[model samples]
Target: MDSSDTPSPIAEPLPYAEVTDPTYAEVAAQNFTVEEVAPDTHVLRGTCPRCNAVLEVPLVGNVFHGMRSIRDVLRKRHTKPSAGDRVEPVICTCEDAHPNRPEGRSGCGAYWTLLLTTEAK
Candidate 1:
């Protein structure tokens, strides 16, 4: 094919998009690995499916770190996972400054639920 006939390659990084698609989260979970960092804390390390930035989630006792600490404090409520607790929610808290991110939020606005397996925890 002629050079001019080929599609132009992208010249810039994709702009940040604020999305909460479950599919993105599902893809992310596939890349995550859970490790017990402490007796009471387990951390999930992986890359963000939406932005491809490294991200970490810590499960301290019954709490997942960084994901909802601020909101729980502001609301004056502490919610715990229900019995069995087979699934935990996760959000991208990647450090890269993605363009168009909201004023007070972090990550690329992607969120998803992570399954807690017996071997992973």
Candidate 2:
């Protein structure tokens, strides 16, 4: 069989600047809150309350609920998240004492991170 017979793998499109660019710091500046809906599960749904922008983090299966940072949410949202997805906090850049703030706005510019958990499929 000719190797060319098979189609090339498709590359996924990158998320919007608001989702990927570190320079776009508004998302970090925005206010949000996390809510627990069940044991070992959570529904992170909030907006940049200051800007009225919609922010959502939905855990599907075996994932556990815990504190997470803005960057973590952005990373998962841009990547492939499925059932048993574990999310947690590693660092943050938000000025409001958020867990994910790494640069902390004044230092290297605002950035955040979230801890992720998931079960093997």
Candidate 3:
């Protein structure tokens, strides 16, 4: 118990006009969904599948084929995005919008991948 002896509760702040603000076609109509977190690594939770524009809080997304998409469920993969040894790919996409990553990079302009499996840990 080292977090200030724990036990802190203070909540109640999400009432922004009945909290109704989810567009982008209702979050691309819920697509792209994966979660393996270990055994190789995997964490693709619907949306951002290429310019659908990051959505979080239900409802997923799936644009054409150029924003980010990687769902390699097994077969030993790692083009980089997780499980260390960063090489690039994790829904990567700044669209080569150039600015040199790292400095608070949340996505590059190209390269992508992040849902590989097949135990490498």
User: Which stretches of model 2 miss by more than 4 angstroms?
Assistant: 1-19, 23-26, 48-52, 61-121
Q: Model 1, 1-121: lDDT tens per residue?
A: 9999999886565466756775664565467776667766877778888778888888776443323222122221123444444466778887677777778777877777665533224
TM-score of structure candidate 1 = 0.63
Q: In angstroms, give how far residue 119 of model 3 lies from its true place.
A: 25
Candidates in order, TM-scores: namely: 0.63, 0.31, 0.23
Best by lDDT: 1
The CA lDDT of each predicted structure is: 0.62, 0.41, 0.35
Comparing candidate 1 with candidate 2, which one achieves the higher lDDT?
A: 1
lDDT by residue (tens digit), candidate 3, 46-113: 55434444433221222112223323332224233344222223343322332444554554332233
Task: Give the CA lDDT, 0 to 100, for residue 112 in model 3.
Answer: 39
Tens-digit per-residue lDDT, 1-120, candidate 2: 699898999754222222234433335433444556776566555443222335555554444544454444445554565655543432222233232333424111222444344323
RMSD of 2: 15.8
With a 3 Å backbone cut-off (N, CA, C), the pairs that clash in candidate 1 are none
Give the Å shift of residue 56 in candidate 1: 0.8
Residue 2 in candidate 3 has what lDDT? 100
Highest TM-score, which number? 1
